[model samples]
Target: MSQTATILVIDDEPQIRKFLRISLSSQGYKVLEAATAGEGLSQAALNKPDLVVLDLGLPDMDGQQALAELREWSQVPVLVLSVRAGEADKVLALDGGANDYVTKPFGIQEFLARLRALLRQAPAGEAAPALVQVGQLRIDLALRRVSLGDAEVALTRKEYAVLAQLARHPGRVITQQQLLKDVWGPSHVDDSHYLRIVVAHLRQKLADEPAAPRYIVTEAGVGYRLMG
Candidate 1:
């Protein structure tokens, strides 16, 4: 997929943009760059890149604002980069609409891994599978049915929503905010406890232990990822 993929890099620092352009280009990805938020937005609308690499500190606008604006019209995957390492900053960005967050001064390999994970969730000119199999679980998205082995596992509406979201992006981390916004509503993004309660119920029904999860893997303060 990298061979024909396009990635947009929005960062003010010349060195940062240059480094990303080189790194992403070397991986057979077409790289588009913008030094300002406005330019990035324009590029994103016009070119419609597969993924975006955004920096929080921008000359024209705050990266979070840019992200919110982007989310309004587009569902493109966005991987945010910031100098701030605080958990709050990460949570805010995730809730604001970022697909993933990576701290500054990050390793190129790890960055590439995160980028690939986000790309995997992007539409690839085909519809997602109707049936997703993960270990002992089977999810039939079209019918909104979930089964473990031969027995059907009944789930609440919210529980099914969360599981389906995770199932769709198996192995990719879905932020609490993203899940809340997608499942509950935008106003409920900050209500992490609502998600926690739902997840607890799901774990109980799925027979998944929080100590060593076999399906839903918690990312602590970040979010959750479904592991097959």
Candidate 2:
């Protein structure tokens, strides 16, 4: 998915744009930069990025105005970033069609996580199977249930979220950051210990051993992939 996920960074600050570009590039997302509101709008229309990281304080115009104008034609996901931490400002951005609001002084992990969340799955419309079969485990995405060889696996919400995400993409390698962000939220992406703990618990429930994994296989210093 990252091979071509272009993210537009709309901010007046060159440093912010550089920071985002570097961070996002490391995560394999293609980065596009715009320093002003008009440039952002023009870039959005011209490039049609997969996701947008927009700042509320643009030099030429307010970010909300750009967002509103954007809403008139596109439904692309926008993560509004601003120094304005006021609730009213957040509400205004959200109401104007922004998908999410992140205040300035945000953690890079969290910011990346929000972007991952926005681009996590395709617009949810395609019908998936009611039950997914992975080895002895059967996942019912609809009923919110998972059964392993006729024994229902009782899992916490976080556990289930992680498993379901991996199950949905059987052979794909989900990055540690992606899984962490998806399961534990953005702020927890860099907390590898937390992910390890959860994965350990999940493996225990699934009767899986890390050394000879039949279910979730650790990709060593990278991420995890459910054996297909």
Which candidate comes out best when scored by lDDT?
A: 1
The number of the candidate with the highest TM-score is 1
Q: Estimate TM-scores for all models.
A: 0.55, 0.53
Estimate candidate 1's alpha-carbon lDDT, on a 0 to 1 scale.
0.88
lDDT of each residue in 1-228, candidate 2, tens digit only: 454689999999999999988998988889999998888877876677888899998889899988876764456789999999999999999999999999999999998888888887536443334357878988765445889998999999888888877876777899999999977899988999988888999999999999999899999999998888
Give the worst 10-residue stretch by lDDT in candidate 1: 123-132
Worst 10 residues of 2 by lDDT: 122-131
In model 2, residue pairs whose N, Cα or C atoms come closer than 3 Å (at least 3 residues apart or on different chains), thus clashing, are none
Candidates' C-alpha lDDT: 0.88, 0.84
TM-score of 2: 0.53
- Please list the Cα RMSD from the true structure of every candidate, rounded to 1 decimal place: 13.4, 15.2
Error of 1 at 38 (Å): 0.3
In model 2, the runs with Cα more than 4 Å from the true position are 1-3, 121-228
RMSD from true fold, candidate 1: 13.4
